[model samples]
Target: MQLKPALGAIVAVSMLAIVFWQQTHLDPKAPDAEFTTLSGEQIVLRELGGQPVLITFWATDCRACIEEIPDLIALHQQFAHKGLQIIAVAMPYDIPSRVKQLSEMRKLPYTVALDIEGVHARAFGDVSLTPSSFLIDRERNVVSRVTGRFNLADWRARIAAM
Candidate 1:
């Protein structure tokens, strides 16, 4: 009957609305951890709550990660002046020297940290995939976590809104 089809369509629309609401409103606190930069500088995750922060887990050997550097740099350049903090953390298996060398060679304009003992990796939800990115709001709540390559335009909009 027509009533049955209308009920099914309503149910589907309700489900979609719930999913969209969750994506836009659900926020979780980021894990607190200490990040050690290549220069031996220490950055505490929780300490950076007044500004939006972008944390990316990458490896020197990951081609996808390597390819995403320029995008990350562009993001940094676009928002760094707007109270955005960007940190790139190398995976546990990536050598510290290589991370430093690549950062220097690329002239990366953001903080580059080393997860030599996998502490950072474990803290950030045991992130094992390359190019994992998390966006934290100024209140220290994690707004989004993308496992692979994410849409650059979407990222720009999210950061710009923050």
Candidate 2:
């Protein structure tokens, strides 16, 4: 009976440590992967180091991803002129034609790339979930990584700070 309490306490402590580590640790460098935008424009991550970049992995069928489109567009409009670069990358399984059509329909005002070969996704820690996002600072260091929907206002403040 005493062992159960002790084990529970240990587990709680380990969980707290993990949460703390995740909250404080940031990736030293963003991937130097190359992205081929839907319009055939090539973008290299390292080349855009002197500006804040938000890279989001998404899919056409994901409702959450679709819902965040407006927030992304807003972010682009608010910060593009201020040196914020936003890239919306479609997942490997997403059809290229669908991705293109949706981008056109929604009039996404940011760089949109398709990861048909999954190379970009793999380079970014094998992101298998939709709506995963990473914020890289001007120094090319990854400052934030979120795997689900996030607060637009919070992200806005973060970018503004960068």
Top candidate on TM-score is: 2
Error of 1 at 131 (Å): 1.0
Give all candidates' CA lDDT scores. Answer: 0.87, 0.89
Query: How many clashes (backbone atoms < 3 Å, residues ≥3 apart in a chain or on different chains) does model 2 have?
Result: 0
Which candidate's lDDT is highest?
2
- What's the distance in Å from true for residue 70, model 1? 0.7
Off-target runs (Cα >4 Å) in candidate 1 are: 1-27
The TM-score, computed over Cα atoms with residue i paired to residue i, of candidate 2 is 0.84
Q: How do all models score by TM-score?
A: 0.82, 0.84
Tens digit of per-residue lDDT, candidate 1, span 30-105: 8887899988999998888789999999998999999999999999999999989999999999988899999999
User: How high is the lDDT of residue 4 in model 1?
Assistant: 98
TM-score of model 1 vs. true structure: 0.82
